[model samples]
Target: MGIESVLSEHRTFHPDQTFVDQANVSGMAHYEKLCVAANENYEQFWADLARELIVWKKPFTQTLNDSNAPFYKWFEDGELNVSYNCLDKHLNTQPNKVAIIFEADNGDVTKVTYKELYEKVCQFSNGLKTFNLDLGDRVVIYLPMGIEAVVAMLACARIGLTHSVVFGGFSAKSIQERIKDAQARLVITADIQFRGGKTLPLQAAVDEAFNLGGCESVIGTVVLKKSKDPIELDSKKIWWHDLIKNQSTKCDPVFVNAEHPLFLLYTSGSTGTPKGVQHSSAGYLLHAMNTMRWTFDIKENDVYWCTADVGWITGHTYVVYGPLAMGATQLIYEGIPTFPHAGRFWQMIEKHQVSIFYTAPTAIRSLIKASELNKESNP
Candidate 1:
C-alpha cells in the first residue's frame, strides 16, 4: 500500500479538519501578476498599497527605484518610520488589540496588547539611548522566544539602531563571532532560559562571549532577571528594570534611508563563520508583510503560531515582522517540540484554536517519525 493508504488504513484526520494544499498552486503566478500590474501602472498600485499599509510623513513622487544594488525599493523617497507604521499607527486603530500571546513550556501564558507593547518598546528604546547607543549602533540580542525580546527588537528598529539577534542555543564562540562581526556596542540577554526540561544560563554565555575580542570592553550588557538562582551579576551587567524603570514611555521614531540596513541575521555556516544576511528597512517590511498576508492566509482574529526561533530568518520574517505588520495575533513559544512530549504542539493548537500554523519541514518529518498525528484522539 502507498504511505497515504497505509496511514488511512491505520488512521485518518477528522472529517471536519480542513486540508489546505497551496503548494501546487504557483506561488510565483500571483507575484508575477503583481509585478506585471505593478509595472503597468506602478504609481497606482504602489500608492494604493502604501496608503493602505504605511504611514507616510511625506508622499513620494517615485514608485520604485531600480538603481539600488539589492534592487527593490518600494515607495522610494517616501518618508515613513518603520516602527511608526508597525506600532504607533496600529495603536491608534487597535490599541487594545492583543498582539502577542506567549506560551511557555511550564504552561504559563501571557498576552500583550499593542498599547502595552508600544509603551514597553518606547521605554526600552529610550533606555538604550541613555547608554548613548545612537542610530547605526548595533545591539546584539541573545534572547529566547518571548515578548521582551520582541520589544527590544522593535525598540531598536524604532530608533534606527541595527539589531543582530543570536539564537539562545548557540555556543559562546558562535555568539562571540556574531558580536564581533557586527561590532555590537550593547548586548541584551536573560538571566536564565528555560527550555524543555533544562535550565540554560543565557547571561553566562553572554559573559563568556564578552571576554572574546569582538565587542568593545566598554559595551553594556543588560540582563533580564527571569529566574532566581543567585546567578552572578556583574557590575557591567545592569538589570532591565533598573535601566528602563524610570524611562519615559514616549519616544519619537527616527526615519531612516530606505536602503539602510535594518537588521543583520547571520546564516549558520557549515565550515566557517556565518554570513550576515542584511535586509533593507522599507523593502524588507513590505515584502515580509505581503508574504505574511497570502502565504499564511492571516486573519485579524487568527491566532498565528510560527514554530521558529528568533535566531533564524524564518522567525524574523514570519513570527515578528510579518504578523506584527499585519496586526495579527502572534504566539511566542519558548521551548522545544519534544519537551514534555510531542503532544505539546497539539495541546497549544487545541487550547488556542490556532487558525494558522507554520513550522519547518524538519518538524513535519519528526512528527511523521513519532506518529503523533495518528496519536490524535480524533484519528
Candidate 2:
C-alpha cells in the first residue's frame, strides 16, 4: 500500500500592500506579462535581456543553438567576461557603493565597496596568472563563506578560468574526488574557518585531500590567513596575501565566448557520485540577474541577505553572482543561524538593516525550533 501523508499545509499569505506597491513586479498582471513575452518567443526574450543587461566585447549573433539536441548552446558567438558584468561595469556609477557587508562569527562586520572589490579581484587574478594557469583551466576553491571566497570565484572568472567550489563542510575524501575530477591545477582555501563560535581547521583538509592521491594536477595551494595559530607551510603552499602583494590591481578582464564555462558546482552525491554541473557565461548571468530582479525585487539602496553557503548553488546564484550582477548590496554571515544565541539572525537583520532575506526551508524550520525552545526556557 502507498504511504499516507501525515502533514498538510493549506495556509496562504499574501504580500504586504507596501511591498506590492514598490516591487519590481508590482502585481499578477506584470508577472503574467513577463511570462507571456517569454512564452511567445523564448529565444528572443533571452537574447534581448543578454544585450540589455550584459556588456559584451562582441555581441552575439545567434541566441540559442540547438543543432545538436540535448547538447544545446546559448549565445554561442558572443564574447564577454563574467567578472566584468558583476564588478567592472559598476565602477563608474557607484564605485563607492557597498557591495558586500560581511558579518563574522564573533559579530564583527566589514564592508567592501565595489571599487575595492574590483581592485582586490584584479590583484588576485594577476596572482593566479603568476602560477602560469592557462585559460579554461580549472581551479578548486575550498574556502569558507567570506569575502575571500567571493574574491577567489571572481578572480577565476576574470581570467577565463573555471572554478569548482567545494563546500568547506565536505569531507577530505569528497574534496579529493572533486579535485581529481576537475583536474584542478590550484586549490584556494583558508587556514581556518570561523563558525558557530568556534575555529575549525580548513587547510588541513586540503592537505589530507592532497595526501590521499589522484590530485597530481594541482601545482600549488593558496592559503588565506585567518587564525593566529601557526600552521606548517610546505613548498606547494603560497600565502594569499603574499601572492597578491606584489601584483598590480589592474588585471584586464579576459573576454571569452559566451558559451565558455564560468564555474563547475558539484551535486551533493546523496544517491550516487557527485557530478560537476557547468554553467556558461552569458546565459547564467542573464538568468541570475533577471531572477534577482524578479524574485527579490532588488532596489538600488536595499541591503539584501541570503543565508546559504557559497558551496551550494543557491549561494552561487544569489549570494555572489546574481546580487553583484544587479549591483545590489548583500550581507554575508560566516556562522550558523543559531550561533552564540538563538536571536543571532534576527539581531543581524535589524543590525544590518536588511531589506530582503532569502533562506532555505530547513533553516526556517531550525529557527522555528530554536524559538520554541527559547520560549520554554524563558517562561
Across 318-347, the per-residue lDDT of candidate 2 in tens digits comes to: 999999989999999999988987789899
Tens-digit lDDT track of model 1 for 63-177: 7776865666766677667777778889878999999999887879999998988999999998989888767888889998899989888988999998999999998989898
lDDT of all the models against the reference?
Answer: 0.82, 0.94
Task: Indicate the TM-score of model 2.
Answer: 0.97
Best by lDDT: 2
What TM-score do all the candidates reach, one by one? 0.86, 0.97
Model 1 residue runs over 4 Å out of place are 1-48, 68-74, 372-379
Clashes of each: 0, 0
